[model samples]
Structures are given as structure tokens and as C-alpha cells.
Target: MVAAALSAETTRAALFLAATVGNVLGALVNYALGRFAIRFEDRRWFPVSPLARQKAETLFARYGQPVLLFSWLPIVGDPLTLAAGLLRTPLTVFLAYVTIGKAGRYAALLWLMPS
Candidate 1:
């Protein structure tokens, strides 16, 4: 989607900005869901597993803020954002890491596409 937008005659920088903003918004939604999940964590039908949360926690412990750079990964990405909220990662800190990671991912994608 982003690449297609970029390929249009639209402003390249604006396209990039829009794409990054969209990605960040999606992550924030995941983070909010994570926060909400904490309240229902003990429910019988909760989707996210304890093991997944544990892995996210362990990775956060080991990598600290840097672990967020992997937030662009496909399967694991959403959970990482959720873990950030579940772990109460500071908002400013979360935004910084997430924005950079997401923007970088989009930038890389745009860069690799044929001009």
C-alpha cells in the first residue's frame, strides 16, 4: 500500500509521512488492545497466550528499548507492541522506538522498490 502510494505522482515525503503515521496508529491500536488484554488475561477465551507474553517480557528484559526495533516483524510485531503496553513502557519511549522502527521499515521498502 505504502509503496503504491509512493509510486504515485504524489509528494514522496508526504507519502512517507502518511505511511509512517498509519503504521504508528496501527501499533498504538495494538498497544491499546494489549492494555485491555491485561484486564482479561485470566479469562477462559483470551487469545494471547502466557507464553507469548513471557517471551515478549524476556525479550524486553534482554534488549530493553532496542527490542522495539523489531516491531516491524510480521507475526511477532503486534505482540511486541502489545507487550510494550502490557509492560507499561513509557509513552514517549514507545513512540520513539516504534516510530523509528516503523518509519525505517517503510523507508527500506520504498528504497528497495524499482524506480
Candidate 2:
């Protein structure tokens, strides 16, 4: 990012694209992992209780989209994407929200840098 900020305008744009694409790809991976975890959801050994599951589903249904806008958060961000996948958030929706959040954060940081 510092390199980009210190480089030409085109370089900054390229760096922004690289950062956004890479971050989004990572979010996709986490989402995929969450999707994979679902295979074990119904197993007797699964950790979540039925009531807990229902409550989680309810919360996600109600607030998931809005919450996803904050998926740019550091440590907390990854789990939000994972939860979105576990709750069966559509791919397009996940991408849109995750991209917006992540890209917005990067954009802000880049903007904050000296030109």
C-alpha cells in the first residue's frame, strides 16, 4: 500500500485492484469452508444445539446483510463471512457485500495515504 501510494496513479489503481481481489478471494475461501462445515451439521456429534441453531438462523435472516457490510473488520471479519456461508447466504449476495466492505476499507486506507 505504501508502495502504491508513492507510485504513479496507475500503479495505485493496480494496487487497489490487487488488494480488493485478493481480499475477496480470501473471503470466498472462508465462505467455502463454512459451506463445507455444513456437511457435518446434522451429525449427532455436531456441537450446536437445535435451539441454538434456530436462534442463529433467525438472527442471520434478520440482520445478516447489514452485518456483512462490516465483514471488513479484522479478526471479526472472517467469521462473519463463514457464518454467512453456514447460514446459506447466496454467492452473489456474499460477494457483493463482502466486496463492498473489504474494498471500501482498502479504498479508505489508500485514500488516507499521501499521494
Candidate 3:
């Protein structure tokens, strides 16, 4: 928000792009964690509790892929990204929706911020 709000005219668009890209990359990390980390979930030291994982899985199962549009949300967003991986969402589809949602969010922020 600060970066979008305070960026100079020459760099504002670049900043916005950077922010969106960074956020999407972070989500990718989360997705990778979900995809690659699930084997350890059966172990005792895994981060998320079983109930939390179940809830995330249930939400993903119920809503399907379009639900990823909400991945720009605050609390629910990160979990949904991870859930996408855990549930075996196709990579291309995941990137398309996630990029759309994340870029849209940054675009909105840039539009709303005062010049």
C-alpha cells in the first residue's frame, strides 16, 4: 500500500507491477509448500493442525477452481493458494487465476490511491 501510494510518477507503474509480481511469487511459494510438503503432513511436526487442513480442503472441494479468484483476500487467500496445490490444481490454471486476482488487486489499489 505504501509503495503504491507514494511511488513517483516515473516508477509508479513499475512499483505496482513489482508488488503484484512479488505477491504472486509468495503465493507460488505457498502453493509449492502445499504441493511438496504434504507428505510430511502425516508426521507429527507438521505446521498446520489436521482440523485446519481439513477445513481448507473442504472449502477447496466445495468451491472448486473459481474460488481462487478470492486469493487476493487477506486471511483466506494464503490458505486457498496452498489448498490449490494440495488438491492438485493444474499449474497453468492456477497461475492464470492467481495472477488475475493478484494483479487486479494491485490495479485497484493504484487506481484508488491519490495522485
Candidate 4:
């Protein structure tokens, strides 16, 4: 949907804006899910186990905010953001780091792609 909207002649700018918004919103959604939906006791639907959550918390605690820079990575990235939210990390700081990470990832992708 984003690629298609970006490709369209009339709505290129709008589509790009929408894509950015959508990406950020997705991160927020992940955060919310991790905070409220995923439970340590209920592992069936959540998938992430208590041990995994503890590991992630430990890693994030050790690494600090810099861990947000990896928010664009596959598999682990989304979960990391969610864990951050679940941990109740400061919202402004999380958003700033996440936006930078996400923007960098998109910019790199665009640069690597052929025109």
C-alpha cells in the first residue's frame, strides 16, 4: 500500500506522509500490545515467554536508550520497541530514538535501490 501510494503521480507527497505516519503508528501499536495484551503468565497467545521478556529487559537495561537504534531490525526490532513500552520507558525519548532509527532504515533502503 505504501509503495503503491508512493508510486502514484498525484498523491506521491501525501502517500509518503501517510507511510511515515503509518510506520510510527505501527510502532505505537506494538508498544501498546506489549504493554497490555502480552502477559507473562499467558504465553499461548503472546508467544514471548517470561524468560525471553526478562532477557529483553536485561538487555535493554544494560544497553540503555541506544537499543532503540535497532528498532528497524527484523524479528527482534518490533519486540524490542514493545518491550520498551512495556518497561514504561520515557515516551519522548523512545519516540525520538525510534523515529531516527526508522528514518535511517528507510533512507538506507531508498539509497540502495535503483532509480
Relative to the true structure, how large is the alpha-carbon lDDT of every model?
0.81, 0.76, 0.81, 0.71
Model 4 residue 50 lDDT? 68
Better of 1 and 3 by TM-score: 3
Model 4 ranges with Cα > 4 A deviation: 1-18, 38-43, 47-52
Task: Kindly provide the TM-score of model 2 when superposed on the true structure, using C-alpha atoms.
Answer: 0.74
For candidate 4, lDDT tens digit of each residue in 32-87? 77777765437576645667667667778889878988877876677777788788
**TM-score for all predictions?**
0.81, 0.74, 0.83, 0.73
| Model 1 regions more than 4 Å off | 2-9, 41-47
Q: lDDT score, residue 83, model 1?
A: 90
Candidate 3 yields a Cα-based lDDT of: 0.81
Which ten contiguous residues of candidate 3 have the minimum total lDDT? 1-10
Per-residue error (Å), model 1, residue 14: 3.0
Rank order (by TM-score, best first): 3, 1, 2, 4
lDDT of 2 by residue, 15-42 (tens): 8899889999988886886678757756
Off by over 4 Å in 3: 7-10, 42-51
What C-alpha lDDT, on a 0 to 100 scale, does residue 113 get in candidate 3?
Answer: 78
Number of clashing residue pairs in every model?
A: 0, 0, 0, 0
Which lDDT value does model 1 have at 106?
80
Q: Which pairs of residues clash in candidate 2, taking residues 3 or more apart in a chain or in different chains? A: none
Descending-lDDT candidate ranking = 3, 1, 2, 4
In model 4, where is the ten-residue run with the lowest total lDDT? Answer: 1-10
